[model samples]
Each structure stands twice: as structure tokens, then as C-alpha cells.
Target: MLSVRAYVPADEARWDAVVAQSRNGTFLHRRAYMDYHSHRYVDASLMVEDDGEPVAVLPANREGDSVASHAGLTYGGLVASRGLRAEATLEAFERIGEHYRGEGIRRFVYKPVPHVFHAAAAEEDLYALHRLGASLVRRDLSSVLSPRERPAMNTMRRRAIARARAAGVAMRVGTDMAPFHALLASVLERHGAVPTHSTAELTLLRSHFPGQIVLHEAHRGDELLAGVVVYDFGHTVHTQYLAASAAGRACGALSLLLAELVGGVYAQRPHFSFGISTEDEGRVLNPGLVAQKESFGARAVVHDRYEWVL
Candidate 1:
């Protein structure tokens, strides 16, 4: 028989061991980061045990009547071991609903895992969510470039990349966080959205990940035009955040920045991820933005989100 309970402090080492062994694991799935970030919200981490051995873990945050899987996490869902099959995953989720309901949580929002990670789970999880009246909100698509293979981009985008390179825009990558944060703030202001992280969070990530947190900057002489902050996870490089100045748009700086990043990844990691974009049928869903990334030979892979209300 299996039992579910709140995460205990002593479970840290064992919990991390499980995450490290799982192919679907990500930094956000680790207990340390989750514990650090969950302080800002409610911590609702659940650990499943089979005869006292930890089998699954799901970290979440509770706010009023709603609960979310790891509030600041980019991707989230249940993390289970082989012993905890599909039926067990569903049973764990059902227990989660009960706990949340008792805690006055009426709605639950779970971040979706990419197909790559989702393939390991028991198929019953999908059915359980639907049977429990969960609703699907949005689906995103991730694009990747494999260093072993040519980038996957359309001809027009390829030409744009060539044109940008021919223009002689210079690209540089570093670990400096100050300039990157400044550029990021400026870009956010242009879009009328406030930054989600403070300088401290950026610093924390840089300190924790070291070479994994890379900053790519595009410049012309003394002027900084665009920059991107990426996370290098050994096998793949993830574009965590990016921003561009007005001068960047005029001088093809964004294109140059991407070219450098892609080249850098090609020289090292097996693949690079361009994150995802919002879906919009009318105008290509940030067409200019998508085009710039697509030019670097990225191909879209659909990502979906799942939710449940208890």
C-alpha cells in the first residue's frame, strides 16, 4: 500500500536522489529550488511512499482557494518512480485534490510537461485529470536545434539569418548579470510587462548554475543592442530570457545574438531549445519574434498544460 504526506525536511537527500535518477527531471523539479521559491507562496509538496520508501513527489503552492504546481516553475507535474505506475500517479493526484480541498483550495493549476518527459508517466494520469473535470487552458510549442543535424528553418528565415550575419553585427557571451538585467528591464518596459525576477534572483541562478547561466550580448562599437540569458543543461541549452533595445531592431542585433548563441551551443551541447510562443492564428503569434528564432533553424514541438479543480 502507498501513502501520501507533506514533504519532510529529512527527505531532501532521498528526494534529490529520485529526481537525479529520473529522465524527466529538471532544475525546477528539485526540492531546493522549489523550497526557495515556494516561500513566497504556500508550500504544498506531496511525497508518496510505498512501505516507507519514497516513490513520487509533487511540489505545489497554495494561494487562497487555488493551488498551483510550483508557482514560479517553467514546467511542472508529478514526478514518480517506476514503482509508482500510472494508477499510482492518479492516486497521488487524487490525494492531492483531497488535501487541497480540505485546505480550502477549490482550483488547481498544474504546469504541463513536454511530450519528452510525459512519455514516462502512466497513461492513466491523462484519464484521471479528464475524469476529475480538469480543463486545458493553453498549448505551447517548443523549437529545438540539434548540433548533430542542420537547423530546421524555412528558406526565408534562413536568408534573414544570412543577411544579419553579412551586416557585420558583433555578438559576445559572458557571465555578467548587470548589463543583461538592464537590457532585460528595457525590453520588458517596451512590452509593458514588469520583470518577474529581481536582480537577486538572477544573481542566485548565476551563482547556483555557474557556466550554465550564460549571457549573450549583441553590440555595435560602444552601443549594446540585444541580449539573451540561456541555461546550459549539459545536453541542451534553454533560452530562459531575452531582451532587445530599439537599436537592436534597427541593426539586426537580435539575429546576430541568436547566431552566436546557436554556434556556441553547436560547439558544445547536443541540442538547443528556443522555449515557446503564444498561439495566435491571425498574426503568427508574435510573428517578428517567432521569425527571428525560427531563422536559427528551430522546429516546433507542441507543449500542453493540464489543470484540475477539486
Candidate 2:
């Protein structure tokens, strides 16, 4: 028999065990990440079990009438063990649907696990997602470079990096909160946005995932130019959050920071995820941002966001 339940504190060990066994799993699937993010977002994690064995897990966050599976998570979806058939996946989704309805959520957003992370899945299990009333939404393209192919800088990229380097820009990596937070805030203001993570959240993530979370800062002597927070998830490196100051822009600091990150930290990982861009072969939203990533030789590997109205 199968059962679906809310995540409990006691399920930590088993939960992590399941995540560890799945290629699609990420740190967001870990208890600590869910707990920390959940505390801020409130009651967002869900799990499914069959005969007392965990079959699937969905990390989600609730805001008003909407319940998003792993809202803050860049890549997310159901975490199932190998050999889970379509019937089982569909059943799990049904249970999840019921749970969302009971919880008064009007919409359920599901983030699909990337293909690279689901090498062992059966076709039927993969198709079950669409079979469950999940419609496609957005997609993100990822770029990767093997260790040997990693180069310092290409033509166009080199020009941008050179401009910054020639201007005497320096890069720093650390976990300090004050300067990092301030620099990020400045970037957000320039972009007419707000910082997503609070100071406390940044501290928690850094403290928990020490080597995994990196704060890269570009500076011209004492002046902070640009900074980005990269997340190193075992096999993939993600440019999670990034920002640049006005002065930094004058010297092309943002480009330099990315060049260093790709050649430096990400060179070690098998795949480096530059995150998503709205630009496709046809014009789409956020074309400029997409073009910027492409100039770095990033290839689009399309993935979808699924949604169901409860």
C-alpha cells in the first residue's frame, strides 16, 4: 500500500537516504536546506511513501494561495528511486494534488528534474508528469565545460575580461556578510530590484554548505565592482545570485567575474550551469541576458516548469 504524508522531523535520516540515492537530488532535497528555507517560506515540503518506503519527495514553499514545489530552487521535481513506473508516479501526483487541495492551495507549480540527473528513469515514469495535468511553463539552459576544454578566455569574452583586468580589477572569494551584502544591495538597487535572501539566510547557507557556496567579488582596489554567489552542488556549479555596482560596470567587472568563475571554480565540476535565459532562436523575454550567456559559448539545454491548478 502507498501513503503520502507531510515531512516530519523524524524522517530526516530516511529523507536524506532517498536523496543520496537519486541523481536528480540536490542540497535543496536535504533536510537542512528545506528546514531553513521552509522556516522563512512556511510549510512547503511534501513526501510520498509506499509500504513505509519513501517513493517520492517534493520540496515546496507556500505563499498565499499558491504552493510551489521548490520555489527558490533552480532545478527541482519529484525524487523517486530507480524503476518507479508511470502508474506509481501518477499515483504520487494524485496524492500530492489532494494534499494541495486540502491545504487550500489554488495552484501547484512543479519544477522538473533535469535530464542529465535522471539517467536511470523509465520513459513511462518521465511521461507520467505530463499525464498528471502538468503543463509546461519556463525553461533554463545550462552550459558546461570539461576540465581539458577549460580555457582562460575566448575572443569576445577575453575582450570583456581584459577591459576589467586592465582597469586593475581584483576578485575576492569569501563568506563575510557585511561587504558582500552591501555590494549585492547596491546591484539590486541599480537593477530596480531587492535582494532575495536575507542576511541571516546567506549566513545559514554559507555556514551549512561551506565549500559549496562561494561569494565572488570583483573590486578595483577598495571599491566593490561586482559580486556573485555560486552554488557548488556535487557535480554541477550554479551561478545562483549575482550583482554589480555602477563603478564595476564602467570597467566590465561583471564579465570578468564570470570569466574567472567559469575557468576557476566551475572548471573542477563536470558541468557548469550558467542558469537560464529567456532568449531562444526566436526572440523571447529577457533576450539581452540570454545573449550575454551565449557569448560565453553556453548551449541551451531546455527544461520545463510544470503546473497544475488544484
Q: Which tens-of-lDDT digit does each residue in 1-310 have in candidate 1?
A: 6777887778888888777665466666777666655558767777777888887777777778887776678776777675666677677777778877887888888775564443244345566687778898767667777755756556765564566677676877655677778878877887787677777787786776676677777777767778878776666678888787776776667766776667654446666788776545222366666666676777776665666768
Off by over 4 Å in 2: 39-44, 62-66, 83-87, 98-107, 116-126, 138-154, 279-284
Count of clashing residue pairs in every prediction = 0, 0
lDDT of 2: 0.73
- lDDT (Cα, tens digit) per residue for candidate 2, span 18-75: 8877656777678877777665676667778888889677777889989877777765
Give the alpha-carbon lDDT of every model.
0.70, 0.73
lDDT for 266 in candidate 1 is 48
